[model samples]
Target: MGREELVRRVSEFAKESEETILNQVRKMGSSLDWSRYAYTLDEKRASAVSHAFVNMYEAGLIYRGHRIVNWDPKGQTTISDDEVVYEEENGKFYYFQYGPFVIGTARPETKFGDKYVVINPNDTRYKEYEHGQQIELEWINGPITATVIMDEASDPEIGSGVMTITPWHSVVDFELAEKHDLDKEQIIDKYGKLLPIAQEFEGMKITEAREKIVEKLNKKGLLVKVDEKYTHNVSKSERTGATVEPQIMEQWFVAVDKPFKIPHSEIKGVKSGDEVTLKQLMRTAVESRDIEMSQNGFRKTYFHWIDNLHDWCISRQIWFGHRIPVWYKGEDIYCGNDAPDGEGWEQDPDVLDTWFSSALWTFSTLGWPEKTKDMETFHPNAFMSPAYEILPLWVSRMILMSSFHLGQVPFKKVLIHGLVRDKSGRKFSKSLGNGIDPLDLVSEYGADAVRMGLLVGTAIGNDINFDESKVKGYKHFANKLWNITRFILENHHEGVPKTLPDKAIGYLDELKHIVAEITTEMEKYHLYLASEKLYHYIWHRVADQILEETKEVFASDEEDAKIAMSHTLNIILTTSLKLLHPFMPFVTETIWQELPQKDEDMLMIAKWPHTKD
Candidate 1:
C-alpha cells in the first residue's frame, strides 16, 4: 500500500478507537480529555527520539555493524521482535539422503547449496561414529565423502544428532559461523534464490527449487522421507502478514552490556561511578525500595532479565519510523540532531526501532527536550499498567531510558494486570473469534455493570476467565444501588437537606473506618479487594443492616427519630456513591443527581470520602 493510504487507514482506525474508549471513560465518569492526551507515535515522538538517539550516540553505545534481523519481505523493512508473531504452519519436514546419513530439514529447497553437516557427540546413534569419519555420499553431480563433526547444536533428543548447516539461511548457523573460523559459503541470495553453487538450478526460488531438488534426489536414490503433516512455528510480519526471512544486514546497536548496571546485585560498572547511568539509577531505586511491583514474583524475572541482558539493536530498515540522523561522507561518520551540511554526505536510510520511540512515551507525551512545564510536571510518572508480555521489551526499556535521560525512573509503580480470556479459557483474540466487545457489553448490561464485572474478581498478574454471569450479577448490584438510593429519597417526605442530623453524624467514625480501608486497598493496587469491600459495605452493611434498623425507627413514629434515621441513610448513600464512583461512575452519577446534591455537582469529580479525625 502507498504511504498515504496506509497512514490514513491507521489514523482513522486509531481515531475511532480513541473515540470509543474516551466515550466509555466519560460514561464511567472520568475527567480525562482525549484530545489533550492522544499522540501519534511517529509524528509527535520524532524529536524526542532524535534527542535520545543523539544522546546515546554521543555516549559511545551506538555503533554500526552487520547483523541478522527479522526481515519482512512484504514490508521490505526490519521489524521489532514484538511486531513479529509466530503462527503454526503445516509443511513437509523433507529429509534428504547425504551419503549413509539422512539429513532432516524443513526447507529442502536450500539443500542444493548446503555446505556441510554437523553431528553432536552426545547422540547415542552418532556416539559410535567418530569425528572426521567420512561417508560416501551420492550426489546428483557426483559422489563425495562428507565428514562429521561434534556440534552441540545437534541434539539427538529432537533429531538424529545431525544438523544440515545452511550458513546463509539460519540465525543459529550465522552466529556459529561468526564465533568459529568456518568458511561461510553463501548459497541462497537475499531474495531466497539459490546462488551459482546450485549448478543448473542456479537462480531458482527456494519454494519451487525444493520440489525439483527433491525429485532429482529421488532419481539419484538419495531421497529419504517427507513428513507432509509436520506442524512448525514460523514468524510473520505483523503489518503485512508476510513470512519473514532472517537476512544478514548491517544495523545500529546499543551496547547494553558492561556500562549498564546489572540488577539483583551491588556491583556498579566502571563508567557508572560519577555518571548517572540507567543502571546506577535502577540499582539505587531497587536498593532504596523506591520501585513498587504489584506482583512481587515478576521482580525476580525482571532481575534475571536485566542481569543477563545483551546488546540491544535499535535500528530498523523501515520507512514508517524516525529516520536516523547520522550522515556519512567517505566512511567518516557524523551524528547529530539534524542531517549533515555537506553535499556529498548522505543520511542513513534506516529508521530507529519502535521501542526506541516508545521508550520516551512517559516524558515525550508530556513534552520533553525543550524543558516545558508539562515535562517538569509529569516527567517522573507515577504508574505504568501495561501487559506482562512487554515487561522486558517496553517496561524495562522505559525505565532505562527515563533514568538515562531524566535522571529518574519514569514510574514509581507498575500494575501488571492479567489478560482477559473467554469462558473456555482461551485468550480473547481476533483470530480466535472469541473476543467479547466491550461496546456490546455496555449496550447490554450498561457501562457500570461492565466495569464492575471486569474489576470484581481480578488479581494481579492473573488471567481473568470472563463469564456473562459476572456481568449479570453486577447489573443486579447496579439495580440494588439504584433501588436503595431511591428508597432513601422516597422516605424523606419533609425535603431533607444535604446537612446531616446529630444522630446521623454519630455514624461518621464507622464510615471513616470503612473509607480508610478502601483507600488503603486502592493505594496498594488491590483493585479486586477494593471492589469486594465496596460490595460488602453497600450490600450487607447499608442495605441489610442499616436499612432494617431505619425501618424499625420509622415504625416508632418519633418525629426527631425519623429525621435522624433518614439523614443517616442519606449520609451512608452519599459516602457509598462517592466510594463506588471510580468503578461504577455512570450508575453513581445517575443516582447522585436524584439526591439533594449541591448545585452543578458531578459525582466523578467529587472528592473521595476520607476518614475524619
Candidate 2:
C-alpha cells in the first residue's frame, strides 16, 4: 500500500486500541508501506538474521568466544557501543591488606577480595619470581595468587602499594588475562559463567555478595584496613543508577576477522560488501577523519572510539529483536551453521540489537540474506549514501559492513548532514519544547513547502534551523508555481508551435546552464545547493524575467506572448518537479500530474534523472 492508504488503515486500527508506536508512527505521518514493514521481532526479520549468521558461520567468521562486552543487565542484554552510555560516577576507593601485600580498590566490600595484585615481570621490584608465574599472594591478612601482567598504570605509591586484578569485573583485568594466557582467570566463560572459583559468590547477586563477603572477611580477620573517605571513578549502569557489575555471563560472540582475508584482485570494485580489503577501508576511514578535521566542519577531537574496539555482542537479552539463530541441545549447541535447519532445538533467546540487523539493513531490507532484483540493481550506488542523521553510527557501520559482507563500499560518497535545530541553535528536544512536529508542519504548510524550507540554507553536516520564515518563503514559491501553471492553462494553447519562435529559444543558453549547475550539485550530494539554485532560477530569474518582458509581448502581440509563456511555463513545471521529488514526493507528484506533457504515473518508480557521471 502507498503511504496515504497505510496511514488511513493505521489510523483506523489506532482508534480501536490503546495508543502505541503504530499510533505514533501514524500521528507523525511516517507514511509507512505496511506491506514492506517488518517489525524487528517479526519472523521474516528473524529468519533473515538467521540466514545471515548461517552464511557467516559456514564461512568460519561467526564463532563462540569470550570477550569484554558492554553488558546491560537490567535490559538483560549485551549491548553494542552505540547502545552504551558513559556517564561520570563518584565512588569510594578502599585501601586494604590481602595477607602480606597491600591492595587498593574501589569495591573493598565485594569482589575486592577476589582481587589479585599483579606485578610486572620487567619491574626490578618483582624480578625475583619466574617472569610469568602467579606467586602465592600472601597479603597482610589472606592468601591468594595472580599471574603478573605488564602495565605502567600501576603506580608504586598507590593504596597498599599494589593493584589487584579481577578479570571478570574490569577491562584491565581481561587485558591482563590475555597477556598472561590465564585460563581460569579469563573474565567470561566457555559456557558463560562467573566461574565456580568465585566460591559462594558464584551466581550470587553481585552487590549483595559484596556486602556478605566483606562482613565475613571482617569476621575472619581477612580485612586488613579500610579507607572510607577516598573517592574514585566507578562504572555505573547508564540506563539505571545502580552500580554496574562486570559479571561473567555465558553469551554468544563472533570473533573479529578470524583469518578473514580478501584477495587484492577480488577486492577491487567492491563498494559495500565482503570483497572490500582491510587496507582500502583503513585508508578510507583515515581519509574521512582527516578531511573532517581539516575542513573545520566537524568536532575536532572525537575520542578514539575505535582504538580498543571489541567483538560486537550481537545478542540482546530481550524479547524485542531477532533472536540469535543457534539452538542449544544441552550445550552441544546445534547451529544451522551450515544450512537451513528447522523446527527442532530451542533457538537462542537473545535478540540481535536493532542496529546489528539494521547494520545489514541497506541490503537486508532490500532482500539480502537472499539476493533479489533490487540488490542486483542498487547494490553499490556509484554515488552516495542518501541520508545524513545516520552519519556516525548507522551510516558508518553500513559502509564497513557492506565492505566486509559484499566486498564493496556500500556507496562511493557519504552524504552527511546534521539534525534540524531550532532558532536559538539548540537541538529540538521534547524537554526544551523546541521540537517541530513534522505532521503539524505538514498540515500548516504542506509537505512540499516544509521540505523546501528544511533545505533552504541547509548544508551537508550543518544544522538547519527550523524557522517559520523559511517555510513561509517556500510556501510562497509553491504558490508562485501554482499561479504560473494556472495562468498557462487559462491563456495558452495546447500544442508546440510548428516553427520555433525566436522569443522561446532566446533564453535557451541560460536554461541549459541552470540544468548543468543543478545536475552538478546533485551529483556531488550538495542537494541543498541544488534546491537553492532551483529556487533562485524559478522565483527571481525566470519568473521575474517573464513578468517584465512577457507584459511587453502581450501588449504588442498575443501569439508571441502565448508561445513564450507556454514554453517557459512547461519548462519550469517539469524541472521543479524533478528537483523536488527526493524531498517532497507527494507535492512534486501532484505537480507532475498537472503537467501537460505526462500521463498519470507514480513518481516513486519514475526513472531517476541522469547526471553526467
Candidate 3:
C-alpha cells in the first residue's frame, strides 16, 4: 500500500487516537525529536535501493534467472518462504470423470489449464498407456495431443496409474514443463480469476469457479464422489489469504552462499549439543559486552533453515515497491543505480521485494552509504529482535548483506519470539475471531498495563497466550505503584538526604543488587525475566516488607527516623523505577516524575542504575 493510503486506512480502522502502529509514537509516548532521524522506505526508496543495487552488482551477487518461487496470485507478487503460512482447513475432494480418464483433485477450479497427466509407470492399472506413447483427447477447450511421460519417481496418480497435470499452477507441473519443453499459458489472473481460455469459466474467482465447475460436473453425472470433510494443508499468501501458485518465473536473485554445506554432505565432529544454536555461533561480542540469544528452543530449527538456504528471489511482480534498477537493451542487460544512458532501454518493471529493501535496514536506517555520523555511531546494532518466522527471510539476509558491505553482522545478538496465540493456542486471526487490536487493549487497560502483561513471564523464543486477566493484573500493579508514590509524598514532604542512615543502608544495597541482576538478564535477551524480577521486588519486597517496616519506624517521631524513612523511600523507589523503565516505560516515567531524587526529567533517558555504591 502507498504511504498515504496506508495512513488513511489505518486512521479509519481505529476508533481512538492510538489504534494502529502508525500512532506508535503517541502510544509509546515517544518524543517528536526522534522523527528527525527517521524516513520511510518509500521516501528514500529510489536512492537507497540504487546504492544497494550498485553494491550487489559490483560484488557480482545480482543476477537474472528463472527460479521456482512461492507466487501469491491474489497479491500478484512473489513472497519469501517466510510469508507462506501453511494452515489446515476443512476442504473437499472432487472425484470426477475428465474426458476419457478419471481423476481426483482438491482444486478443480485450476483444472481448466490442465496440460497433460502422468501416471506411475510401475502401476498396472493403465497398462495400455505406455511410456513415450502419443494419445489424442478431445477437450472442452480445444483439440490437444497428450504425450505419456510415465513413472515419475513420485508421480501424481489418479487411482492406480493415471495422472493429470496443471501446468501453470502446481510445482510438479512447472518442473515437468521445464523437463519436457512444454509451454505454459497462464489460465489464472492475478486475482485468482480464470483467463479467457476457460471460455464459459473465464473471469470467475476461485470460489465462483468452484461453484460453477461443481454444478457443471453434477449436471453431466461426472461427479463420482465428493469427500466433504477432506482436511488438507494449504499454502496461502500470508499477506492476502489467497492460495499460492507455484509458477516458474524469471526473477533477480541475491546469491548468498549457504553457510553450511548441503544436507548430509560431510560430518567430522559436529553433533548434537556440540554447537547449541545458529544464533550462539553467530553471537557477536562488542567490546566488553556479549549477546548470546536465540528464540526458545528453535535453535535447531534455525540451523536447519540456514544449512539448506537458497538464493533469495529479490524481485516482485508489483508496481509500488522499489523498482529494480537494471535496464534491458535488446537482451544485453545493464544494471546500475540509474537508467541506461540511451533510449530503448527498458528498465525492469518489477520492483524489489519489500524485504530486499529491509535486508539493508540495519545500515540504511542509520544513514549508511555516505559514512555519516549516524552510520559510524550505530554501525553494528546492539540487538536485533524480530519474530522467529523471519530468521531466514530477514535476519540471515541482513547478516550476509551487512557483512559484505560493512564487514560485520548488523547486530551483536538476535532475539526471536513467537506469535501471540489465543487462550486455545490458536493463532489470533480474523477468521478465528480472536484478533486483538493493540488500540483496543490500550484504550481498555492503558498502554503500560498491556505491555507489562506481555513481557512479564515471556521467554526468549516463546509464544504467550493472550489473556485479559493478565492485563487486568498488571493494571492493578500500575495502580499499586501510583498509590505507593502518593503515600510516600504525603508522609515525607522533606528533601532527600545526601547520605543514607544505618537503617536505610540495607534497603539501598538490595535496590542496587536488583539493578545489577536486571542488567545481566537483559544482556542475554531475557527482558521478560527482568520484568518478572521487578514485579516481585516492587510488590513483595518494597511494598509489603520495607514500606511496612518504615511506617512503624516513622511512628516513633524521632527526627533521625523520619529523615532515614524519607531517604530510603526516595532512593529505593527511584532506583526501582529505572529498572522497570524498559518493560513498562510510561508507568515508570509517570511515577518517576513525582519522586524527589530523579536525575533526569524523563526516566527514559536517565543513567541506568548499577550495583556499585
Candidate 4:
C-alpha cells in the first residue's frame, strides 16, 4: 500500500483505541507538547537530523573505513556494538580427513568439500608436515590431509588435532584473512545471492548448500568419523535467528575508541596522561553514574560492559533511517560535511543505525544546529526520564554523544524506572503471553489512575508488579478527587482568599510547603515522590479535613467560607495537574483546560510551580 494509506490506517488504528489512547495522551500532556510532536518518520524530524549530522561531520567526528560488523540479512541492516546478543548452543566437533591430515570443527557439516584445515605447527603430530605435504592422518580408524594454519583455539586431544578454517562462515577466518592478506573466498552477497566463484553451490540456499555439500563429501569417502552432540556457542544474526555468514566485504565503520577512554590495566594502559581532561570529564562521568550509587554494588554488574567497550559500527544496509551522508567517487570516497552539493559522487545507500538518530534526540528535538529560543533555555533541560532497560542502550550513548558535541550531559539528572512485571515477578513478554495491554488497562482505569498505579509502590530503579486491584484503587482515588472538586465548586466559584484567618494560617503554610516540595522533586526527576505528595495532600488535607471542617462555616457564613473553599480548591486542582503532568500528560491537559481559567492558555507551557523567595 501507499505511504498515505499506511499513515491513514495507523491513525485510524490509534483512533479506534479511544479510552486508552486518550488517557495516555492526557498523561503525557505537560512533558510533551502534542502540537510540536515529531515522530521518527516525520520529514521535519528528518530535516532536523540532517542538520545535526552536518554539524557533527564538520566537527571531524564522522568518518568511514572498512571494519568487522554484525550483519542482519533479514532486515538488510548492520547494527552497532550495543545491539548484538550472544547466546550459547549445542553442536559437535567433527574429526575428519583431507588427503593426509586431521581436522576438527564444531560444525562437522561445514567440513564438507573443504580444501584446507589449519593445524598449529607446535602440535607434534603435524610438525613434520611443515608446508602442506603428506602426514599420516590416522584417527583411531582413518586418514585426512589439508593445509593447516596455526592457531591455539584448537586442542591436540580433541578430534583431529587441527581447527578447521571456513572463511565463508566464521569470524576466526576474517581475522586470519587480514593477518595473511588472504583473498577471502566468501561468495555470498548481502542479499544471500551466490557470487560467481560459488558456482557449484551457486543459487543454492545456505541450508541447501550445507546438505548437498555434506552428502557429496560422504560419497567421495572424505568422511573419517563424527562426534555427536557437542555443546558450544554459535553466532546468530541479532535481527534474524539465521546462522550468520562471516564473509569478507567492504563495510563502513567509525572509530569509537577515539571518544572512549578504556580503563588502565596491566596489559593495556589507555590513560591519556597530561592531555586527558579528567576533572571536568569526571564530573560528567559521575553524573552518568547512578545518582545515589546503589548500596548493593549493582554498578559492578554494569562494569564489564563499560570496561571493554568496542568502537561502534553505525552504518546499516537499510532503506529506512537517516542514510549516511558520505558519497563515493570511484576508488576514493567523500564525506559530506554538509548536504552533498551537485557533484559527481553517488551517495552511500546505507542508513545509520536507528540509535544514531536517537542519540541526537535530546538536542535535535530542541533545534540543535541553529540556536533557537527553546535551544537556549531547555536544550540542556533540567533532567531526563528514561526507562531503566535502555540505560545501556540509549542512555549511555546519549551521554557520550551529547558530551562530545554539546559539552554537557544531555540532561542533568537521569530518572530510571524498571519494567512492569506480573504479580509473580516474571517480566512481561509477548511469547510468554503474560503481557498486559496498556490500552486495555487505560480503558478500564483512567489514564491518571493507571499512571498512579504504576508508580504507587515503585521506587527509583525498582520494578513494579501489575495488579488490577491496585489500578482500581487509584481509579477510586481519582473519583474522590473529582467529587471533592465538584463539592468545592458548589460552595465557592470565586478566586482564592485575599486574607488568611488565624485558624487557616497553619494549613496555608502547609499547602505552600507541599507545593514547593513537589516542584523540587519533579524538577529533580523524582516523579514518583511528587505524585505521592500530591495524592497525600489532596486526599487527607483537602478531602477529609478541609471539606469537612469548612462545610458548617459555608452554611452559616457565605463570604468567609467562599474564601477558604476557593483557596483550597485552587491549590488542589493546580497541584494535582502539575504533579500528574508528566505521567498522565493528556488527561491533565484536558483537566487543566476545563478548569475555571483564562482563555488562550495552554496547559503544557504553564510555569511549573516554584518555591517562594
TM per prediction = 0.82, 0.70, 0.75, 0.68
Name the top lDDT candidate: 1
For model 3, state the Cα shift of residue 538 in Å. Answer: 1.7
Instruction: Report how far off residue 338 is in candidate 3 (Å).
Output: 2.1
For model 1 the local lDDT of residue 391 reads 82
Q: What would the TM-score be for candidate 3 when compared with the true structure?
A: 0.75
- The worst-scoring run of ten residues by lDDT in candidate 1 lies at 261-270
- In order of TM-score, best first, we have 1, 3, 2, 4
Error of 3 at 481 (Å): 2.7
Better candidate number, 3 or 4, judged by lDDT? 3
Of 1 and 2, which scores higher on lDDT? Answer: 1
Question: Mind giving the per-residue lDDT tens digits that candidate 2 earns over 1-613?
Answer: 7645754676567456534556545643345577776554355556667776776666666666667666655655565555544555555454555545556665643353353456544456655645455667544235656554556556655443356676666667767767666543433333223345556556655555555656666676656666556555555454554445554556665555354554322233333324433334533543554212232433222223334445556666665445577776555676673333555567676766667676666667667767789788877654433334344456555655665666555665444567778988886766788887676776888777887888767887777767888887788888887776676555555666555466666555566667678888887778889888888887787667755566555456567456766666566556656766676666667767766675337666665444321
Candidates by lDDT, descending order: 1, 3, 4, 2
TM-score leader: 1
Which tens-of-lDDT digit does each residue in 1-613 have in candidate 3?
7855855675455446434555754684545565655433445645776888887766566777876778887788888778888889998998876556777889887776665667676776667777677667644455567667674643444352465677777766777777877667777776668888878998888777886787776786777788899999999888898888776678888775523222211112323224222232233222113333444355556566666656678888766567788888897988787777978999888878877777788888776676789877876777777887787777776765665556555776677887788877888877878888776788888888888878888876788888889998999999989877876777674754566677689888778788888899987768888889989999998888888888876778676668767877877878888887777788888888777666898897899887874
Q: What's the true lDDT of residue 211 in model 3?
A: 68
Candidate 3 achieves a global lDDT of 0.72
